[model samples]
Target: MFYKEIFSFIAIAITLAAFIPYIREIFRGTIRPHIFSWVIWGVTTLLIFVAQLEDHGGVGTWPIGVSASITIFIAYLAFIKRADVTITCGDWLFFIAALLSLPLWYWTSDPLWAVILLTAIDVAGFGPTVRKAYQFPYSESLLFFALFTLRNVLVMLALENLTLTTLLFPAVMLVLCILMMAMIAYRRRVLFA
Candidate 1:
Protein backbone atom coordinates (compact mmCIF):
# COMPACT_ATOMS: atom_id res chain seq x y z
CA MET A 1 0.00 0.00 0.00
CA PHE A 2 2.78 2.37 0.93
CA TYR A 3 4.68 1.66 -2.24
CA LYS A 4 1.58 2.23 -4.29
CA GLU A 5 1.14 5.61 -2.69
CA ILE A 6 4.80 6.44 -3.26
CA PHE A 7 4.48 5.53 -6.90
CA SER A 8 1.54 7.87 -7.33
CA PHE A 9 3.36 10.70 -5.58
CA ILE A 10 6.48 10.23 -7.67
CA ALA A 11 4.46 10.16 -10.85
CA ILE A 12 2.86 13.46 -9.93
CA ALA A 13 6.20 15.03 -8.98
CA ILE A 14 7.71 14.00 -12.29
CA THR A 15 4.80 15.60 -14.09
CA LEU A 16 5.24 18.84 -12.18
CA ALA A 17 8.99 18.75 -12.84
CA ALA A 18 8.30 18.72 -16.55
CA PHE A 19 6.44 22.01 -16.21
CA ILE A 20 9.11 23.82 -14.22
CA PRO A 21 10.20 25.84 -17.23
CA TYR A 22 6.65 26.90 -18.06
CA ILE A 23 6.04 27.84 -14.45
CA ARG A 24 9.16 29.97 -14.39
CA GLU A 25 8.11 31.73 -17.54
CA ILE A 26 4.73 32.49 -16.05
CA PHE A 27 6.33 33.99 -12.97
CA ARG A 28 8.77 36.03 -14.98
CA GLY A 29 5.99 37.86 -16.71
CA THR A 30 5.64 41.53 -15.80
CA ILE A 31 2.81 40.57 -13.49
CA ARG A 32 2.73 36.97 -12.41
CA PRO A 33 -0.97 36.34 -12.85
CA HIS A 34 -2.21 32.72 -12.70
CA ILE A 35 -0.21 32.02 -9.60
CA PHE A 36 -3.44 31.26 -7.79
CA SER A 37 -4.26 28.44 -10.13
CA TRP A 38 -0.75 27.05 -9.84
CA VAL A 39 -0.83 27.30 -6.06
CA ILE A 40 -4.24 25.61 -5.86
CA TRP A 41 -3.01 22.71 -7.94
CA GLY A 42 0.14 22.52 -5.89
CA VAL A 43 -1.81 22.36 -2.64
CA THR A 44 -4.09 19.68 -4.02
CA THR A 45 -1.07 17.64 -5.04
CA LEU A 46 0.38 18.00 -1.57
CA LEU A 47 -2.83 16.96 0.09
CA ILE A 48 -2.97 13.82 -2.03
CA PHE A 49 0.60 13.07 -1.02
CA VAL A 50 -0.22 13.60 2.66
CA ALA A 51 -3.28 11.42 2.51
CA GLN A 52 -1.23 8.65 1.01
CA LEU A 53 1.41 8.92 3.71
CA GLU A 54 -1.21 8.81 6.39
CA ASP A 55 -2.72 5.71 4.88
CA HIS A 56 0.74 4.18 4.97
CA GLY A 57 1.09 5.00 8.68
CA GLY A 58 3.91 6.48 10.83
CA VAL A 59 5.25 8.73 8.08
CA GLY A 60 3.45 11.87 9.17
CA THR A 61 2.46 14.48 6.57
CA TRP A 62 5.60 16.56 6.15
CA PRO A 63 5.03 16.93 2.45
CA ILE A 64 1.75 18.65 3.16
CA GLY A 65 3.57 21.25 5.24
CA VAL A 66 5.99 21.93 2.45
CA SER A 67 3.18 22.13 -0.04
CA ALA A 68 1.31 24.52 2.22
CA SER A 69 4.33 26.76 2.25
CA ILE A 70 4.49 26.66 -1.53
CA THR A 71 0.83 27.56 -1.69
CA ILE A 72 1.49 30.51 0.61
CA PHE A 73 4.19 31.73 -1.73
CA ILE A 74 1.80 31.27 -4.62
CA ALA A 75 -0.85 33.27 -2.78
CA TYR A 76 1.66 36.01 -2.25
CA LEU A 77 2.38 35.99 -5.94
CA ALA A 78 -1.30 36.11 -6.78
CA PHE A 79 -2.40 38.62 -4.18
CA ILE A 80 0.57 40.55 -2.83
CA LYS A 81 2.61 40.74 -6.02
CA ARG A 82 -0.56 41.63 -7.90
CA ALA A 83 -0.18 38.93 -10.50
CA ASP A 84 -3.80 38.88 -11.56
CA VAL A 85 -4.06 37.15 -14.88
CA THR A 86 -7.45 36.57 -16.39
CA ILE A 87 -8.74 33.03 -16.71
CA THR A 88 -9.70 31.93 -20.19
CA CYS A 89 -12.61 29.71 -21.14
CA GLY A 90 -10.28 26.78 -21.49
CA ASP A 91 -8.94 27.31 -18.03
CA TRP A 92 -12.46 27.19 -16.71
CA LEU A 93 -13.09 24.02 -18.67
CA PHE A 94 -10.02 22.36 -17.22
CA PHE A 95 -11.13 23.44 -13.79
CA ILE A 96 -14.54 21.96 -14.38
CA ALA A 97 -13.11 18.68 -15.62
CA ALA A 98 -10.98 18.39 -12.52
CA LEU A 99 -13.97 19.04 -10.35
CA LEU A 100 -16.05 16.48 -12.18
CA SER A 101 -13.34 13.88 -11.80
CA LEU A 102 -13.27 14.22 -8.03
CA PRO A 103 -16.23 11.92 -7.39
CA LEU A 104 -15.04 9.39 -9.91
CA TRP A 105 -11.65 9.35 -8.26
CA TYR A 106 -13.12 8.74 -4.82
CA TRP A 107 -15.86 6.28 -5.67
CA THR A 108 -14.03 4.10 -8.12
CA SER A 109 -12.30 1.04 -6.78
CA ASP A 110 -10.32 0.41 -9.91
CA PRO A 111 -7.65 3.07 -9.95
CA LEU A 112 -6.57 2.38 -13.49
CA TRP A 113 -10.06 2.66 -14.92
CA ALA A 114 -10.67 5.76 -12.89
CA VAL A 115 -7.51 7.37 -14.24
CA ILE A 116 -8.43 6.34 -17.76
CA LEU A 117 -11.82 7.95 -17.42
CA LEU A 118 -10.28 11.14 -16.09
CA THR A 119 -7.74 11.24 -18.90
CA ALA A 120 -10.40 10.61 -21.48
CA ILE A 121 -12.51 13.51 -20.33
CA ASP A 122 -9.45 15.73 -20.19
CA VAL A 123 -8.37 14.83 -23.72
CA ALA A 124 -11.85 15.36 -25.03
CA GLY A 125 -12.09 18.78 -23.49
CA PHE A 126 -8.46 19.84 -23.98
CA GLY A 127 -8.56 20.91 -27.61
CA PRO A 128 -11.27 23.48 -27.12
CA THR A 129 -9.86 24.63 -23.80
CA VAL A 130 -6.44 25.21 -25.28
CA ARG A 131 -7.83 26.93 -28.34
CA LYS A 132 -9.74 29.31 -26.10
CA ALA A 133 -6.67 30.12 -24.03
CA TYR A 134 -4.68 30.81 -27.16
CA GLN A 135 -7.15 33.54 -28.02
CA PHE A 136 -5.42 35.68 -25.37
CA PRO A 137 -1.99 34.81 -26.73
CA TYR A 138 -1.58 32.74 -23.59
CA SER A 139 0.68 30.23 -25.25
CA GLU A 140 2.20 29.31 -21.94
CA SER A 141 -1.24 28.55 -20.62
CA LEU A 142 -1.84 26.19 -23.48
CA LEU A 143 1.54 24.55 -23.04
CA PHE A 144 0.94 24.24 -19.34
CA PHE A 145 -2.38 22.52 -19.91
CA ALA A 146 -0.88 20.27 -22.55
CA LEU A 147 1.84 19.22 -20.16
CA PHE A 148 -0.79 18.49 -17.56
CA THR A 149 -2.83 16.33 -19.89
CA LEU A 150 0.35 14.59 -20.96
CA ARG A 151 1.15 13.91 -17.35
CA ASN A 152 -2.20 12.32 -16.70
CA VAL A 153 -1.96 10.20 -19.81
CA LEU A 154 1.50 9.10 -18.79
CA VAL A 155 0.25 8.22 -15.37
CA MET A 156 -2.52 6.08 -16.80
CA LEU A 157 -0.06 4.30 -19.04
CA ALA A 158 2.30 3.62 -16.21
CA LEU A 159 -0.27 2.51 -13.72
CA GLU A 160 -2.37 0.51 -16.12
CA ASN A 161 0.43 -1.28 -17.99
CA LEU A 162 -1.35 -0.32 -21.15
CA THR A 163 -0.35 -2.01 -24.38
CA LEU A 164 0.58 -0.43 -27.72
CA THR A 165 -2.97 0.63 -28.46
CA THR A 166 -2.69 2.99 -25.53
CA LEU A 167 -0.19 5.01 -27.51
CA LEU A 168 -2.95 6.46 -29.67
CA PHE A 169 -4.11 9.04 -27.19
CA PRO A 170 -0.73 10.59 -26.52
CA ALA A 171 0.08 10.63 -30.21
CA VAL A 172 -3.14 12.45 -30.96
CA MET A 173 -2.53 14.91 -28.17
CA LEU A 174 0.98 15.66 -29.43
CA VAL A 175 -0.33 16.35 -32.90
CA LEU A 176 -3.04 18.59 -31.57
CA CYS A 177 -0.62 20.56 -29.43
CA ILE A 178 1.69 21.14 -32.39
CA LEU A 179 -1.12 22.17 -34.71
CA MET A 180 -2.61 24.50 -32.14
CA MET A 181 0.68 26.21 -31.49
CA ALA A 182 1.29 26.64 -35.18
CA MET A 183 -2.14 28.10 -35.75
CA ILE A 184 -1.74 30.46 -32.84
CA ALA A 185 1.66 31.63 -33.98
CA TYR A 186 0.47 32.11 -37.52
CA ARG A 187 -2.51 34.14 -36.44
CA ARG A 188 -0.42 36.22 -34.05
CA ARG A 189 1.76 37.31 -36.96
CA VAL A 190 -1.06 37.79 -39.45
CA LEU A 191 -3.54 39.47 -37.14
CA PHE A 192 -1.11 41.90 -35.57
CA ALA A 193 -2.13 44.44 -38.23
Candidate 2:
Protein backbone atom coordinates (compact mmCIF):
# COMPACT_ATOMS: atom_id res chain seq x y z
CA MET A 1 0.00 0.00 0.00
CA PHE A 2 2.77 2.41 0.85
CA TYR A 3 4.62 1.42 -2.31
CA LYS A 4 1.56 2.12 -4.40
CA GLU A 5 1.27 5.62 -2.96
CA ILE A 6 4.96 6.24 -3.51
CA PHE A 7 4.75 5.07 -7.08
CA SER A 8 1.69 7.20 -7.67
CA PHE A 9 3.47 10.28 -6.40
CA ILE A 10 6.54 9.49 -8.47
CA ALA A 11 4.44 9.05 -11.56
CA ILE A 12 2.72 12.35 -10.92
CA ALA A 13 6.02 14.16 -10.43
CA ILE A 14 7.60 12.68 -13.52
CA THR A 15 4.54 13.42 -15.61
CA LEU A 16 4.52 17.06 -14.54
CA ALA A 17 8.26 17.43 -15.00
CA ALA A 18 7.93 15.97 -18.48
CA PHE A 19 5.35 18.51 -19.56
CA ILE A 20 6.96 21.57 -18.05
CA PRO A 21 9.62 21.87 -20.74
CA TYR A 22 7.11 21.14 -23.47
CA ILE A 23 4.83 23.84 -22.19
CA ARG A 24 7.74 26.22 -21.93
CA GLU A 25 8.69 25.45 -25.52
CA ILE A 26 5.15 26.12 -26.63
CA PHE A 27 5.17 29.44 -24.81
CA ARG A 28 8.49 30.29 -26.41
CA GLY A 29 6.98 29.67 -29.85
CA THR A 30 9.37 26.76 -30.45
CA ILE A 31 6.67 24.08 -30.52
CA ARG A 32 3.40 24.68 -32.27
CA PRO A 33 0.99 22.12 -30.89
CA HIS A 34 -2.22 21.48 -32.75
CA ILE A 35 -5.19 22.96 -30.96
CA PHE A 36 -7.48 20.09 -31.86
CA SER A 37 -5.01 17.52 -30.60
CA TRP A 38 -4.45 19.21 -27.26
CA VAL A 39 -8.16 19.91 -26.79
CA ILE A 40 -9.14 16.31 -27.42
CA TRP A 41 -6.26 15.07 -25.28
CA GLY A 42 -7.36 17.28 -22.41
CA VAL A 43 -10.93 16.11 -22.58
CA THR A 44 -10.20 12.43 -23.09
CA THR A 45 -7.54 12.39 -20.39
CA LEU A 46 -9.98 13.93 -17.94
CA LEU A 47 -12.51 11.25 -18.81
CA ILE A 48 -9.95 8.50 -18.47
CA PHE A 49 -8.74 9.92 -15.17
CA VAL A 50 -12.28 9.88 -13.83
CA ALA A 51 -12.79 6.33 -15.02
CA GLN A 52 -9.50 5.25 -13.49
CA LEU A 53 -10.38 6.87 -10.18
CA GLU A 54 -13.68 5.05 -10.08
CA ASP A 55 -12.09 1.78 -11.15
CA HIS A 56 -8.89 1.92 -9.10
CA GLY A 57 -9.88 4.17 -6.21
CA GLY A 58 -7.04 6.61 -7.01
CA VAL A 59 -4.29 4.07 -6.77
CA GLY A 60 -2.79 4.91 -10.16
CA THR A 61 -4.85 7.90 -11.22
CA TRP A 62 -2.94 10.81 -9.73
CA PRO A 63 -0.66 11.09 -12.74
CA ILE A 64 -3.52 10.91 -15.18
CA GLY A 65 -5.47 13.58 -13.31
CA VAL A 66 -2.41 15.81 -13.27
CA SER A 67 -1.79 15.15 -16.95
CA ALA A 68 -5.32 16.19 -17.80
CA SER A 69 -4.82 19.47 -16.00
CA ILE A 70 -1.56 20.16 -17.83
CA THR A 71 -3.11 19.19 -21.13
CA ILE A 72 -5.75 21.86 -20.64
CA PHE A 73 -3.07 24.45 -20.08
CA ILE A 74 -1.15 23.35 -23.17
CA ALA A 75 -4.34 23.40 -25.21
CA TYR A 76 -4.94 26.97 -24.20
CA LEU A 77 -1.37 27.91 -25.10
CA ALA A 78 -1.74 26.29 -28.51
CA PHE A 79 -4.97 28.11 -29.19
CA ILE A 80 -3.50 31.47 -28.38
CA LYS A 81 -0.21 30.98 -30.19
CA ARG A 82 -1.91 30.30 -33.54
CA ALA A 83 1.10 29.12 -35.47
CA ASP A 84 1.44 29.68 -39.18
CA VAL A 85 -0.15 26.45 -40.14
CA THR A 86 -3.45 25.30 -41.52
CA ILE A 87 -5.83 22.92 -39.80
CA THR A 88 -7.18 20.44 -42.28
CA CYS A 89 -10.82 19.44 -42.54
CA GLY A 90 -9.97 15.94 -41.41
CA ASP A 91 -8.69 17.35 -38.15
CA TRP A 92 -12.06 18.91 -37.53
CA LEU A 93 -13.72 15.61 -38.30
CA PHE A 94 -11.63 13.84 -35.70
CA PHE A 95 -12.32 16.58 -33.17
CA ILE A 96 -16.04 16.21 -33.73
CA ALA A 97 -15.79 12.45 -33.41
CA ALA A 98 -13.89 12.89 -30.16
CA LEU A 99 -16.52 15.25 -28.81
CA LEU A 100 -19.29 12.86 -29.80
CA SER A 101 -17.57 9.90 -28.17
CA LEU A 102 -17.75 11.54 -24.74
CA PRO A 103 -21.54 11.46 -24.57
CA LEU A 104 -21.66 7.97 -26.01
CA TRP A 105 -19.27 6.74 -23.32
CA TYR A 106 -21.29 8.49 -20.63
CA TRP A 107 -24.47 6.95 -21.95
CA THR A 108 -22.93 3.50 -22.02
CA SER A 109 -21.73 3.75 -18.42
CA ASP A 110 -18.97 1.27 -19.03
CA PRO A 111 -15.52 2.24 -17.89
CA LEU A 112 -13.87 -0.25 -20.19
CA TRP A 113 -15.74 1.03 -23.20
CA ALA A 114 -15.07 4.57 -22.12
CA VAL A 115 -11.32 4.00 -21.96
CA ILE A 116 -11.31 2.18 -25.28
CA LEU A 117 -13.31 4.84 -27.05
CA LEU A 118 -11.35 7.61 -25.41
CA THR A 119 -8.10 6.00 -26.41
CA ALA A 120 -9.25 5.77 -29.98
CA ILE A 121 -10.40 9.36 -29.94
CA ASP A 122 -7.12 10.44 -28.41
CA VAL A 123 -5.14 8.72 -31.15
CA ALA A 124 -7.38 10.10 -33.84
CA GLY A 125 -6.96 13.54 -32.36
CA PHE A 126 -3.21 13.19 -32.90
CA GLY A 127 -3.77 13.04 -36.65
CA PRO A 128 -3.34 16.74 -37.23
CA THR A 129 -0.28 16.97 -35.01
CA VAL A 130 1.22 13.94 -36.67
CA ARG A 131 0.75 15.55 -40.03
CA LYS A 132 2.18 18.79 -38.79
CA ALA A 133 5.12 17.10 -37.12
CA TYR A 134 5.85 15.32 -40.37
CA GLN A 135 6.13 18.67 -42.07
CA PHE A 136 7.87 20.47 -39.21
CA PRO A 137 9.63 18.03 -36.99
CA TYR A 138 10.85 20.64 -34.57
CA SER A 139 7.28 21.75 -34.02
CA GLU A 140 6.97 18.98 -31.44
CA SER A 141 9.20 17.78 -28.66
CA LEU A 142 10.68 14.30 -28.73
CA LEU A 143 11.63 14.53 -25.06
CA PHE A 144 8.05 15.21 -24.03
CA PHE A 145 6.62 12.18 -25.77
CA ALA A 146 9.44 9.97 -24.58
CA LEU A 147 8.86 11.08 -21.01
CA PHE A 148 5.15 10.59 -21.47
CA THR A 149 5.83 7.02 -22.51
CA LEU A 150 7.89 6.59 -19.39
CA ARG A 151 5.16 8.16 -17.30
CA ASN A 152 2.58 5.77 -18.70
CA VAL A 153 4.84 2.86 -17.88
CA LEU A 154 5.29 4.14 -14.35
CA VAL A 155 1.58 4.68 -13.97
CA MET A 156 0.93 1.14 -15.13
CA LEU A 157 3.47 -0.17 -12.67
CA ALA A 158 1.88 1.87 -9.94
CA LEU A 159 -1.52 0.28 -10.49
CA GLU A 160 -2.68 -1.64 -7.44
CA ASN A 161 -5.53 -3.28 -9.30
CA LEU A 162 -5.10 -4.01 -12.95
CA THR A 163 -8.08 -4.38 -15.26
CA LEU A 164 -9.03 -3.54 -18.80
CA THR A 165 -10.26 -0.15 -17.71
CA THR A 166 -7.10 0.58 -15.81
CA LEU A 167 -4.71 -0.80 -18.39
CA LEU A 168 -6.15 0.16 -21.75
CA PHE A 169 -5.59 3.89 -21.68
CA PRO A 170 -1.97 3.73 -20.55
CA ALA A 171 -1.14 0.94 -22.99
CA VAL A 172 -2.64 2.84 -25.89
CA MET A 173 -0.89 6.01 -24.81
CA LEU A 174 2.45 4.25 -24.63
CA VAL A 175 2.09 3.00 -28.18
CA LEU A 176 0.89 6.36 -29.45
CA CYS A 177 3.78 8.11 -27.75
CA ILE A 178 6.20 5.77 -29.44
CA LEU A 179 4.53 6.33 -32.77
CA MET A 180 4.65 10.08 -32.31
CA MET A 181 8.31 9.89 -31.38
CA ALA A 182 9.01 7.83 -34.47
CA MET A 183 7.13 10.31 -36.62
CA ILE A 184 9.13 13.19 -35.19
CA ALA A 185 12.38 11.30 -35.63
CA TYR A 186 11.59 10.39 -39.21
CA ARG A 187 10.72 13.95 -40.02
CA ARG A 188 13.88 15.20 -38.41
CA ARG A 189 15.93 12.73 -40.39
CA VAL A 190 14.32 13.62 -43.67
CA LEU A 191 14.34 17.34 -43.05
CA PHE A 192 17.93 17.56 -41.88
CA ALA A 193 19.27 15.25 -44.58
User: Candidate 2 overall Cα lDDT vs. reference?
Assistant: 0.86
What's the C-alpha lDDT at position 5 in model 1? 48
Clashes of each: 1, 0
Residue-by-residue lDDT tens digits, candidate 2, 1-193: 7888888888898898899898888778898889999999999999989988878646688899999999998888888888535788888888888888768778767788888888888888888888888888898889999998998998888887799899888989999999999989988998889
* Model 1 regions lying over 4 Å from their true place: 1-18, 30-84, 88-94, 124-132, 138-160, 164-176
The residue pairs that clash in candidate 1, if any, are: 33-83
| Model 1 root-mean-square deviation | 7.8
Model 2 ranges off by over 4 Å: none
Q: Report RMSD (Å) for each prediction in the order shown.
A: 7.8, 1.3
Kindly list the per-residue Cα lDDT of model 1 for residues 82-119, writing each as its tens digit: 55456666667665766566556456554444435544
